[model samples]
Target: MTQDIWTLIVVILVFLGILALMIRGWRNRTRSQAGLFDSLPEVPAETGEVVLGPLTGVYIGSTVAGDWQARIARAPLGHRSAGTLTAFTGGLRLDLADATVWIPRSDLQTVRRASALANKTVPGGGILVARWQVDGPDGTTEIDSGFRADDKDTYPRWEALRGDAAPTTRPDTPSSTTEENK
Candidate 1:
C-alpha cells in the first residue's frame, strides 16, 4: 500500500511539472509576439536618417522606380527566405531564398538614416525603395522592398536580419574571389 502511494505521488509530481512547462512555453511565445509589435517607433514623414534594426531576413524582390519594376528572380534559400516580417496587416514569413537564413523577427531594435520618412507616398506608391542586398556564404541575394514608418510591426523582421548574432564585421580588404571578380 505504501509503495502504491509513493507511485501516485510521483505521477502527480510529473503531471504538475509538465503542466508548468506548458504554461511557461505559452507565456514565452506570447511575450515574443508582443515584443515584435511593441518594438517599432513611429516614423515621421520628414525623418531622413532612419536606422533599421537587424532584419529577420533580407528581402528577395526587385526594385521598381517609376515605370520599371523588379520581381524576385531566384531564391537560393528555397521558395522563401527563412525569416519573418510585418506586412501591411499582420506578420509574414520572408521566404525568398533556398538556404533559409533563420532570422528571428524579434531582433530588429532600431532604424536610423532612412530616406523613407520624408516620402509619405512611398509605402504603396512613389519611387521604389532602395534594393537591399546581402552576400552570404553561398552567393548574393537582393530584395526590392522599402522600409515603411507606419508599419512598425516589421521591426522584428529587421531585427532578425541585423541582430548582434549576424556576421562579424570584416576588414576593408577584399576577398580573393572579389579580387578575381574585379
Candidate 2:
C-alpha cells in the first residue's frame, strides 16, 4: 500500500511539472513576440447590424503578415477559439468567445484562401485568411488572421469582396447562405 501511494504521488508530480513547463513556455513565447502583437481596434457602434454573416467557425490563429511559421502569442489574438465572422461597413468583425476583434476595411490589405496557419492545417484552401494592418510595438505591422468557416462554400463569396481595396461601405452579399445577413 505504501509503495503504491508513493508511485501515484510521483506520477502526479510529473504531470504537474509538465503543466508548469507548458505555461512557462507560453509566457516566454508571448514575451518574445513583441512585434507580433498589437491592440485590436474597438468594433464600431453601428457594427451591431451584421451586413453579412456571423459565420460560425474556429479562429485558427494569426501570424506575422507573411510568415506562416511564426505564430502570434498575444492573448485572444494568439489563442484559438470557436469564432464567428461578420461583415460591416467599417470592416470584418471576428468574434471569438473570449473577445471581439475589429478589422477595419481601411486597414485591410487583402483576403485570401489558405491551407494552413501556425498551429492548424487544413485541405488546400480551407482557411479564409484576412490580411490587415495594425499598430504594433514596432509601428504598423501586417497580420494574417485565419478563420475556417463552418460552410466552406462561403469562402468564394468572401474572397470575392476584394478586401485588398476594401470598400468604404458594406458591400452587398453575393447571395445568401444558411447564415443570413444578421
Candidate 3:
C-alpha cells in the first residue's frame, strides 16, 4: 500500500509539472506572436552597416505587469529558446531558434544600458535595453529587448547604431578601487 501511494504521488507531481510547462509555453507564444503581422513591410539592411555579433545564447524575455519573465527555453516541455541578437545599420534583429524579430530604426524609440534582465541580475551595466514598437494584432505596441553583451567590445558600435552617445563610463565593469582591493 505504501509503495502504491508513493507511485501515485510521483505521478501527480509529474502531471503538475507538465501542466505548469504547458501554461508557460502558451503564455509565451501568445506574447511573442501577438505583434506578428503578415502584412507588415520589411526594410533592407543598408550597406556598410556594422554587424555587432550574432551575440549568441542570450536570454530573451518579455514584460508582464512591469516585470520581465523569460519567454521559454527550447528544451523539453518549454518553448523559450536561446536567441542571437544582431545590430546593423538600419536596426536590430533577434533570431530565435523558432522565430525571428526585426526592429527597424523607425520603430525604435530608445536604447539604454541596464544591469539586469528577466529575473537575473547582470553585474555592471552590461545589458543593452531597447524599447521599440511593433505591429501587433491590435495595432502598434511597445516591446523591450532584454539583452546582455557577451562581448563588451561590441557595445560602442551598438550604441552608435542606436544614435546614443558612447557612455562616458560603464558601471558593469569592476571599479579600479574594487580591483585594487581584491
Candidate 4:
C-alpha cells in the first residue's frame, strides 16, 4: 500500500519522539525533587532552628572530616541527634543533614538568599543563606557563614530581649559585636 503507509509514518514518528523524552524526564525529576523538598523550612524540633527565609537551602553537612564521624555514628543509633549543613549551590557542593540533601546533577545555581531574621524568644531562632563560590581541590572557598537559628545563646537572648531596639550602631565587620545589654 504506499510502502506500508511510509513505514507506519516513520514508526509513529519514532514513538512520539520517545514519548516526549520520557515525559520530559519525568517532569524534570518531579521538579527537582520539589525544589529540594521545598528548600527545607519549618525546622524547630525543640531547637533544630529554621525560623525563616532562604533558610534550608545551603547544605553540605560533610565532605571529608570523616563525614562528621559518620554522622556522629548514625546519631545515637538512629535515635536522631546529629547535625550537618554545608552549602554551595551552582558550582556544586551540598551535603545536608537530618537525612540527606545532596544535589549535583549539573548546571545548578539555585541557593540564593541574603537576609533573614528571627528571635522571638528563641524557641529555635532563625537566619538563612546559601550563597556560593567555591573551587575544589583546596583552592577557592568563599562561603559567608551565619546560620545560627537557635543555639549559641540565641544571640544573647535576642539582644537581651531587644532593649534599646537592638542596634547600637557598630558595623565595622569583625563579626560585629557591641552588645551593651540592650
Candidate 5:
C-alpha cells in the first residue's frame, strides 16, 4: 500500500511538470506571433504587379492617431523577418512570414520621414513609415508601414513613388547623416 501511494504521487508530479512545460511553450509562441504580426489586417491577393522591390524589413504594426506605441515584445529583436512589399495600381501588398498586410492606395494617408518608428530606430538615413487605414471586422484602424530597405538611402526613391503625398522635407535628423560617415 505504501509503495502504491508513492507511485501515485510520482505520477501526479510528472503530469504537473509536463503541464507546466506545455503552458510555457504556448505562451512563448503567442508572444512571438504578436511581435511578428501585431494587429495587421489581412493581406490582399497578390496580382502579377511589380512596382516595389521584394524589400526585406522589420514590420512593426498598424499605427493609430494617438501615442499607441509598439509592444516591447514586438520589438525588432523579438520579431524580425524578411518581407516583400509589392505596389500595385490599386494598393500595396506586404508579405511576411507571419502576416500579410494589404493597404489600398486610396487609404494611404501620408508617407512621412521618421527617425524612430514604433520603437525600431532606422539608423542611417531614417525610415519612411506610410500611414494608411483599413476597415475590418475590428472597425477602421490606421496601419503604419514599418519597412526599411537594406539600403537606407533608397528612401528618396520610395518617396517619389508615392507621388505628391510624400513629404517634401527629407529626414534631416542628425542621426540620419551620422551613419554615412562610417
Candidate 6:
C-alpha cells in the first residue's frame, strides 16, 4: 500500500509540473503578443445594416497572415470558441462566445476558403478565412481569422462577402440608385 501511494504521488507531481510549464509558456506567449492588442479595432457602437449572417459556426482563431501555424496569442485572438459571423455595411463582426471582434470593411483584404488555421483542422475548404489588415506600432499586420459554419451550404454565401457583395463602404449614394439613403 505504501509503495502504491508513493508511486501515485510521484505521478501527480510530474503531471503538475507539466501543467505549470504549459501555463508559463502560454503566459509568455500572451505577453509577447501584447503589442498586437492595441491594433485590434474597437467594437463599433453600431455595425450598420446586416449584409449577411447570423451564420452559426466555430471561430477557429486567427493567425499572422499566410502562416497557418503562427496563431495570434493575444487575448481573444488565439482561442477557439463558438461564434456568430455577421457582415454589415460597416464590416464583419465575429461574435465569439468569449469576445467580440470587429473588423471594419475598409480593413478587409479578401475572404478565402481554408481547412487549417491556428490549431484547428477541419476538412478541406471547411473554413472561411477573412484576411484583413490592422494597423499597429509595426505599421500594418495582415491577419486571417477562420470560421466554419454549422451548415456547409453557408460557405458560398459567406464567400460572397469578399467580392462585389461586401462593399468596403456604404455608398453615400449608390450610383445604381437615383438617390441613395445617407
**Which candidate number maximizes lDDT?**
6
Write down the RMSD of candidate 5 (Cα, Å). 10.0
Clashes of each: 35, 0, 5, 7, 0, 0
Evaluation by TM-score, superior candidate among 4 and 6: 6
Higher-scoring candidate on lDDT, 1 or 4: 1
Encode model 6's per-residue lDDT on 1-182: one tens digit a residue.
69999999999999999999998998898887675547578878887999988889889889876567778888678788999998998899999987899888888877778877887777767888897777765555667798888887877777777633232222221223111111
- Each model's lDDT comes to 0.33, 0.75, 0.55, 0.29, 0.54, 0.76
- Candidate 1 overall lDDT versus native: 0.33
Which candidate, 4 or 5, would have the higher lDDT against the true structure? 5
RMSD of 2: 9.0
Displacement of residue 36 (Cα, Å) in model 5 is 18
Clashing pairs in 3: 72-80, 73-80, 74-80, 124-172, 125-172
Which model is ahead, 3 or 5, in terms of TM-score? 3
Between candidates 3 and 5, name the one with more favorable lDDT. 3
Instruction: Kindly provide the TM-score of model 4 when superposed on the true structure, using C-alpha atoms.
Output: 0.20
- Model 6 reaches what TM-score against the true structure? 0.83
Give the Cα-based TM-score of candidate 3 against the true structure.
0.59
| Reference-based TM-score, model 1 | 0.22
lDDT of 1 at 168: 22
Tens-place lDDT per residue, model 1, 35-135, is 11222122223322324432444332322121112222232321223333332211222333343222222322112222231112333332213323344
In candidate 5 the C-alpha lDDT for residue 160 amounts to 58
Per-prediction TM-score to the true structure, in the order listed: 0.22, 0.79, 0.59, 0.20, 0.54, 0.83
lDDT per residue, candidate 3, 5-57, as tens digits?
99999999999999999889777775565443333335464623746777775
After superposing candidate 5 on the true structure, give the runs of residues whose Cα lies further than 4 Å from its correct spot: 1-48, 66-79, 136-139, 163-182
Quote the lDDT for 89 in model 4: 23
- Please list all clashing residue pairs in model 2, or write none if there are none: none
Candidate 6 ranges beyond 4 A from true positions: 37-39, 163-182
